[model samples]
Target: MAGLPSTARVVIIGGGVVGTSSLYHLCKAGWTDCLLLEKNELTSGSTWHAAGNVPTFSSSWSLMNMQRYSTELYRGLAEAVDYPMNYHVTGSLRLAHTKERMQEFQRARGMGRYQGMDIDVVGLEEIKRRYPFIETHDLKGALYDPSDGDIDPAQLTQALAKG
Candidate 1:
Protein backbone atom coordinates (compact mmCIF):
# COMPACT_ATOMS: atom_id res chain seq x y z
CA MET A 1 0.00 0.00 0.00
CA ALA A 2 2.94 2.32 0.53
CA GLY A 3 4.01 2.59 -3.08
CA LEU A 4 0.44 2.71 -4.38
CA PRO A 5 -0.91 6.12 -5.42
CA SER A 6 -3.49 8.09 -3.43
CA THR A 7 -6.23 7.53 -6.00
CA ALA A 8 -6.93 3.87 -5.39
CA ARG A 9 -8.37 1.71 -8.13
CA VAL A 10 -11.09 0.15 -5.96
CA VAL A 11 -13.27 1.66 -3.22
CA ILE A 12 -15.26 -0.66 -0.96
CA ILE A 13 -18.39 0.70 0.72
CA GLY A 14 -18.81 -1.43 3.87
CA GLY A 15 -16.70 -2.73 6.75
CA GLY A 16 -18.55 -5.95 7.53
CA VAL A 17 -17.56 -9.50 6.72
CA VAL A 18 -18.70 -9.18 3.11
CA GLY A 19 -16.67 -6.08 2.50
CA THR A 20 -13.70 -7.35 4.47
CA SER A 21 -13.75 -10.58 2.55
CA SER A 22 -13.64 -8.64 -0.71
CA LEU A 23 -10.75 -6.56 0.54
CA TYR A 24 -8.84 -9.62 1.75
CA HIS A 25 -9.24 -11.41 -1.55
CA LEU A 26 -8.37 -8.30 -3.50
CA CYS A 27 -5.17 -7.90 -1.53
CA LYS A 28 -4.36 -11.56 -1.94
CA ALA A 29 -4.96 -11.20 -5.67
CA GLY A 30 -2.43 -8.31 -5.70
CA TRP A 31 -4.90 -5.46 -5.90
CA THR A 32 -2.83 -3.40 -3.51
CA ASP A 33 -4.23 -0.07 -4.67
CA CYS A 34 -7.59 -0.39 -3.00
CA LEU A 35 -9.39 1.33 -0.12
CA LEU A 36 -12.37 0.37 2.01
CA LEU A 37 -14.32 3.31 3.43
CA GLU A 38 -16.60 2.64 6.38
CA LYS A 39 -19.27 5.19 7.26
CA ASN A 40 -18.94 4.03 10.87
CA GLU A 41 -16.66 1.79 12.87
CA LEU A 42 -15.95 -1.70 11.61
CA THR A 43 -18.82 -4.09 12.45
CA SER A 44 -20.99 -1.22 13.75
CA GLY A 45 -24.05 -1.76 11.56
CA SER A 46 -25.79 -5.02 10.51
CA THR A 47 -22.49 -6.85 10.81
CA TRP A 48 -22.71 -6.59 14.60
CA HIS A 49 -26.18 -8.11 14.67
CA ALA A 50 -25.45 -11.03 12.35
CA ALA A 51 -25.44 -14.51 13.90
CA GLY A 52 -22.55 -15.87 11.88
CA ASN A 53 -23.91 -18.98 10.19
CA VAL A 54 -22.03 -20.57 7.30
CA PRO A 55 -24.39 -20.04 4.36
CA THR A 56 -23.67 -23.36 2.69
CA PHE A 57 -25.93 -25.98 1.17
CA SER A 58 -27.29 -23.79 -1.55
CA SER A 59 -29.21 -24.95 -4.62
CA SER A 60 -27.97 -22.32 -7.06
CA TRP A 61 -24.55 -22.77 -8.60
CA SER A 62 -23.52 -19.14 -7.98
CA LEU A 63 -24.57 -19.25 -4.33
CA MET A 64 -22.85 -22.58 -3.90
CA ASN A 65 -19.61 -21.22 -5.32
CA MET A 66 -19.70 -18.20 -3.03
CA GLN A 67 -20.40 -20.37 0.02
CA ARG A 68 -17.70 -22.82 -0.97
CA TYR A 69 -15.18 -19.99 -1.12
CA SER A 70 -16.43 -18.65 2.19
CA THR A 71 -16.09 -22.06 3.79
CA GLU A 72 -12.55 -22.33 2.48
CA LEU A 73 -11.70 -18.87 3.81
CA TYR A 74 -12.99 -19.68 7.28
CA ARG A 75 -11.21 -23.01 7.24
CA GLY A 76 -7.97 -21.25 6.34
CA LEU A 77 -8.38 -18.95 9.31
CA ALA A 78 -8.83 -21.97 11.56
CA GLU A 79 -5.95 -23.91 10.06
CA ALA A 80 -3.09 -21.97 8.41
CA VAL A 81 -3.38 -18.55 10.00
CA ASP A 82 -3.04 -18.16 13.77
CA TYR A 83 -6.18 -16.00 13.64
CA PRO A 84 -8.79 -17.86 15.70
CA MET A 85 -12.28 -16.97 14.37
CA ASN A 86 -14.33 -18.28 17.32
CA TYR A 87 -15.79 -20.76 14.83
CA HIS A 88 -17.72 -23.83 15.99
CA VAL A 89 -17.89 -26.76 13.60
CA THR A 90 -20.46 -28.75 15.58
CA GLY A 91 -22.76 -28.65 12.47
CA SER A 92 -26.34 -27.45 11.68
CA LEU A 93 -29.40 -29.43 12.70
CA ARG A 94 -32.82 -28.48 11.30
CA LEU A 95 -35.56 -30.28 13.20
CA ALA A 96 -39.06 -30.96 11.88
CA HIS A 97 -41.99 -32.57 13.65
CA THR A 98 -44.78 -31.41 11.34
CA LYS A 99 -45.52 -32.54 7.80
CA GLU A 100 -45.22 -29.04 6.27
CA ARG A 101 -41.71 -28.41 7.58
CA MET A 102 -40.71 -31.96 6.65
CA GLN A 103 -41.73 -31.32 3.05
CA GLU A 104 -39.65 -28.17 2.93
CA PHE A 105 -36.68 -29.97 4.42
CA GLN A 106 -36.96 -32.72 1.86
CA ARG A 107 -36.94 -30.25 -1.02
CA ALA A 108 -33.94 -28.50 0.43
CA ARG A 109 -32.16 -31.80 1.08
CA GLY A 110 -32.64 -32.87 -2.53
CA MET A 111 -31.15 -29.60 -3.70
CA GLY A 112 -28.22 -29.86 -1.28
CA ARG A 113 -27.55 -33.40 -2.48
CA TYR A 114 -27.10 -32.06 -5.99
CA GLN A 115 -24.89 -29.28 -4.67
CA GLY A 116 -22.59 -31.81 -2.93
CA MET A 117 -22.62 -30.31 0.55
CA ASP A 118 -22.48 -32.70 3.51
CA ILE A 119 -26.20 -32.45 4.16
CA ASP A 120 -28.27 -35.51 5.04
CA VAL A 121 -31.41 -36.83 6.67
CA VAL A 122 -31.15 -38.01 10.28
CA GLY A 123 -33.62 -39.74 12.57
CA LEU A 124 -34.36 -39.18 16.26
CA GLU A 125 -31.82 -41.78 17.36
CA GLU A 126 -29.05 -40.21 15.32
CA ILE A 127 -29.92 -36.76 16.63
CA LYS A 128 -29.75 -37.96 20.22
CA ARG A 129 -26.35 -39.54 19.62
CA ARG A 130 -24.95 -36.47 17.88
CA TYR A 131 -26.33 -33.72 20.11
CA PRO A 132 -27.62 -34.85 23.47
CA PHE A 133 -28.14 -31.27 24.64
CA ILE A 134 -31.33 -30.86 22.61
CA GLU A 135 -34.69 -32.24 23.77
CA THR A 136 -36.00 -34.21 20.79
CA HIS A 137 -39.23 -35.69 22.10
CA ASP A 138 -41.80 -34.31 19.64
CA LEU A 139 -39.31 -34.01 16.80
CA LYS A 140 -39.68 -36.60 14.01
CA GLY A 141 -36.33 -36.10 12.21
CA ALA A 142 -33.71 -33.56 11.10
CA LEU A 143 -31.47 -32.49 8.21
CA TYR A 144 -27.96 -32.53 9.48
CA ASP A 145 -25.57 -30.41 7.40
CA PRO A 146 -22.22 -31.58 8.75
CA SER A 147 -20.13 -28.88 7.09
CA ASP A 148 -22.55 -26.19 8.32
CA GLY A 149 -21.30 -24.24 11.30
CA ASP A 150 -21.21 -20.92 13.21
CA ILE A 151 -18.68 -18.16 13.65
CA ASP A 152 -17.91 -15.15 15.83
CA PRO A 153 -18.66 -12.03 13.81
CA ALA A 154 -16.48 -9.65 15.77
CA GLN A 155 -13.38 -11.82 15.77
CA LEU A 156 -13.80 -12.86 12.17
CA THR A 157 -14.03 -9.25 11.00
CA GLN A 158 -10.92 -8.25 12.92
CA ALA A 159 -8.98 -11.23 11.69
CA LEU A 160 -9.91 -10.62 8.07
CA ALA A 161 -8.97 -6.96 8.32
CA LYS A 162 -5.58 -7.78 9.78
CA GLY A 163 -4.90 -10.67 7.47
Candidate 2:
Protein backbone atom coordinates (compact mmCIF):
# COMPACT_ATOMS: atom_id res chain seq x y z
CA MET A 1 0.00 0.00 0.00
CA ALA A 2 1.15 3.55 -0.70
CA GLY A 3 1.28 6.12 2.04
CA LEU A 4 -1.42 8.80 2.00
CA PRO A 5 -0.27 12.31 1.21
CA SER A 6 0.07 14.55 4.24
CA THR A 7 -2.26 17.09 2.63
CA ALA A 8 -4.25 17.84 -0.51
CA ARG A 9 -6.04 20.80 -1.95
CA VAL A 10 -9.24 18.76 -2.06
CA VAL A 11 -9.86 15.30 -0.58
CA ILE A 12 -12.82 13.38 -1.98
CA ILE A 13 -14.05 10.21 -0.24
CA GLY A 14 -14.88 7.00 -2.12
CA GLY A 15 -14.31 6.36 -5.83
CA GLY A 16 -17.88 5.94 -6.94
CA VAL A 17 -19.54 7.83 -9.77
CA VAL A 18 -20.19 10.99 -7.79
CA GLY A 19 -16.72 11.16 -6.33
CA THR A 20 -14.92 10.52 -9.59
CA SER A 21 -17.18 12.90 -11.45
CA SER A 22 -16.49 15.60 -8.89
CA LEU A 23 -12.78 14.99 -9.22
CA TYR A 24 -12.94 15.11 -13.00
CA HIS A 25 -14.94 18.32 -13.08
CA LEU A 26 -12.67 19.90 -10.53
CA CYS A 27 -9.60 19.07 -12.56
CA LYS A 28 -11.27 20.34 -15.69
CA ALA A 29 -11.90 23.60 -13.87
CA GLY A 30 -8.17 23.88 -13.00
CA TRP A 31 -8.30 22.31 -9.56
CA THR A 32 -5.58 19.71 -10.14
CA ASP A 33 -4.27 19.23 -6.61
CA CYS A 34 -7.16 16.95 -5.62
CA LEU A 35 -7.03 13.51 -4.07
CA LEU A 36 -9.59 10.70 -4.04
CA LEU A 37 -9.47 7.98 -1.37
CA GLU A 38 -11.18 4.65 -1.95
CA LYS A 39 -11.40 1.73 0.45
CA ASN A 40 -11.63 -0.70 -2.50
CA GLU A 41 -11.42 -0.70 -6.26
CA LEU A 42 -13.41 1.94 -8.05
CA THR A 43 -17.06 0.99 -8.58
CA SER A 44 -16.57 -2.17 -6.49
CA GLY A 45 -19.52 -1.18 -4.35
CA SER A 46 -23.05 -0.10 -5.39
CA THR A 47 -21.78 1.61 -8.55
CA TRP A 48 -20.84 -1.68 -10.12
CA HIS A 49 -24.33 -3.03 -9.54
CA ALA A 50 -26.13 0.00 -10.93
CA ALA A 51 -28.35 -0.66 -13.94
CA GLY A 52 -26.82 2.47 -15.64
CA ASN A 53 -30.05 3.13 -17.48
CA VAL A 54 -30.02 6.68 -18.83
CA PRO A 55 -33.52 7.82 -19.64
CA THR A 56 -34.93 11.27 -20.32
CA PHE A 57 -38.40 10.29 -19.24
CA SER A 58 -39.63 12.14 -16.22
CA SER A 59 -42.70 14.05 -15.04
CA SER A 60 -40.45 16.68 -13.51
CA TRP A 61 -38.85 19.07 -15.97
CA SER A 62 -35.71 19.49 -13.89
CA LEU A 63 -35.10 15.74 -13.63
CA MET A 64 -35.69 15.19 -17.32
CA ASN A 65 -33.26 17.97 -18.19
CA MET A 66 -30.66 16.60 -15.82
CA GLN A 67 -30.98 13.11 -17.28
CA ARG A 68 -30.68 14.48 -20.78
CA TYR A 69 -27.57 16.42 -19.79
CA SER A 70 -26.07 13.31 -18.21
CA THR A 71 -26.71 11.29 -21.34
CA GLU A 72 -24.98 13.91 -23.46
CA LEU A 73 -22.09 14.17 -21.04
CA TYR A 74 -21.55 10.41 -21.05
CA ARG A 75 -21.66 10.37 -24.83
CA GLY A 76 -18.64 12.68 -25.06
CA LEU A 77 -16.78 12.27 -21.80
CA ALA A 78 -15.00 9.07 -22.84
CA GLU A 79 -13.59 10.47 -26.06
CA ALA A 80 -12.46 13.63 -24.31
CA VAL A 81 -10.51 11.66 -21.71
CA ASP A 82 -9.24 8.97 -24.13
CA TYR A 83 -11.06 6.31 -22.11
CA PRO A 84 -13.83 3.95 -23.10
CA MET A 85 -17.03 4.61 -21.20
CA ASN A 86 -18.98 1.85 -22.98
CA TYR A 87 -21.96 4.06 -23.59
CA HIS A 88 -24.71 2.50 -25.69
CA VAL A 89 -27.43 4.57 -27.27
CA THR A 90 -30.07 1.87 -27.22
CA GLY A 91 -32.95 4.30 -26.68
CA SER A 92 -35.92 3.71 -24.30
CA LEU A 93 -39.59 2.86 -24.60
CA ARG A 94 -42.59 3.09 -22.32
CA LEU A 95 -44.79 0.35 -23.70
CA ALA A 96 -48.53 0.77 -23.67
CA HIS A 97 -50.49 -2.46 -23.45
CA THR A 98 -53.97 -1.02 -23.04
CA LYS A 99 -56.06 2.00 -24.01
CA GLU A 100 -55.49 3.62 -20.62
CA ARG A 101 -51.76 3.11 -20.89
CA MET A 102 -51.74 4.50 -24.41
CA GLN A 103 -53.54 7.61 -23.19
CA GLU A 104 -51.00 8.03 -20.42
CA PHE A 105 -48.14 7.69 -22.88
CA GLN A 106 -49.71 10.26 -25.15
CA ARG A 107 -49.95 12.72 -22.28
CA ALA A 108 -46.36 12.10 -21.28
CA ARG A 109 -45.22 12.47 -24.84
CA GLY A 110 -46.95 15.81 -25.01
CA MET A 111 -45.13 16.91 -21.88
CA GLY A 112 -41.83 15.78 -23.30
CA ARG A 113 -42.42 17.62 -26.55
CA TYR A 114 -43.41 20.75 -24.65
CA GLN A 115 -40.13 20.56 -22.82
CA GLY A 116 -38.22 20.52 -26.18
CA MET A 117 -37.45 16.83 -26.12
CA ASP A 118 -37.57 14.73 -29.25
CA ILE A 119 -40.07 12.28 -27.79
CA ASP A 120 -42.94 10.67 -29.63
CA VAL A 121 -46.02 8.60 -28.87
CA VAL A 122 -45.34 6.13 -31.59
CA GLY A 123 -47.76 3.51 -32.84
CA LEU A 124 -47.42 -0.26 -33.07
CA GLU A 125 -46.22 -0.05 -36.66
CA GLU A 126 -43.35 2.25 -35.77
CA ILE A 127 -42.40 0.09 -32.84
CA LYS A 128 -42.47 -3.02 -34.97
CA ARG A 129 -40.40 -1.30 -37.64
CA ARG A 130 -37.79 -0.31 -35.09
CA TYR A 131 -37.69 -3.69 -33.34
CA PRO A 132 -38.75 -6.44 -35.69
CA PHE A 133 -38.10 -9.29 -33.25
CA ILE A 134 -40.02 -7.83 -30.30
CA GLU A 135 -43.20 -9.58 -29.20
CA THR A 136 -45.47 -6.60 -29.68
CA HIS A 137 -48.76 -8.44 -30.03
CA ASP A 138 -49.82 -7.27 -26.55
CA LEU A 139 -48.61 -3.71 -27.04
CA LYS A 140 -50.84 -0.92 -28.29
CA GLY A 141 -48.22 1.79 -28.59
CA ALA A 142 -45.29 3.38 -26.77
CA LEU A 143 -43.60 6.59 -25.76
CA TYR A 144 -40.18 6.58 -27.27
CA ASP A 145 -37.07 8.62 -26.50
CA PRO A 146 -34.30 8.03 -28.98
CA SER A 147 -31.68 9.76 -26.87
CA ASP A 148 -32.16 7.42 -23.93
CA GLY A 149 -29.56 4.70 -23.53
CA ASP A 150 -27.33 2.68 -21.20
CA ILE A 151 -23.77 3.10 -19.98
CA ASP A 152 -21.23 1.03 -18.06
CA PRO A 153 -20.90 2.53 -14.62
CA ALA A 154 -17.53 0.99 -13.90
CA GLN A 155 -16.03 2.15 -17.18
CA LEU A 156 -17.49 5.60 -16.67
CA THR A 157 -15.95 5.82 -13.23
CA GLN A 158 -12.57 4.84 -14.62
CA ALA A 159 -12.88 7.44 -17.37
CA LEU A 160 -13.73 10.08 -14.81
CA ALA A 161 -10.76 9.05 -12.75
CA LYS A 162 -8.54 9.33 -15.78
CA GLY A 163 -9.70 12.87 -16.26
Residues 82-152 of candidate 1 have per-residue lDDT tens digits of 67778777677888898777776777777777766667878899999988888998998987877777889
- Maximum-TM-score candidate: 2
**TM-score of model 2 relative to the true fold?**
0.78
**What overall lDDT goes with each candidate model?**
0.79, 0.86
Q: Which stretches of candidate 2 lie over 4 Å from their true place?
A: 1-11, 30-34, 98-100, 114-116, 133-138
What are the TM-scores, per candidate, against the unseen true structure? 0.75, 0.78
Cα lDDT for residue 35, candidate 2? 91
Question: Please, what are the lDDT tens digits per residue for candidate 2 over residues 25-105?
Answer: 898899968899889889977899999888988866788777777887898898888997788998877888999988877
User: What's the C-alpha lDDT at position 61 in model 2?
Assistant: 71
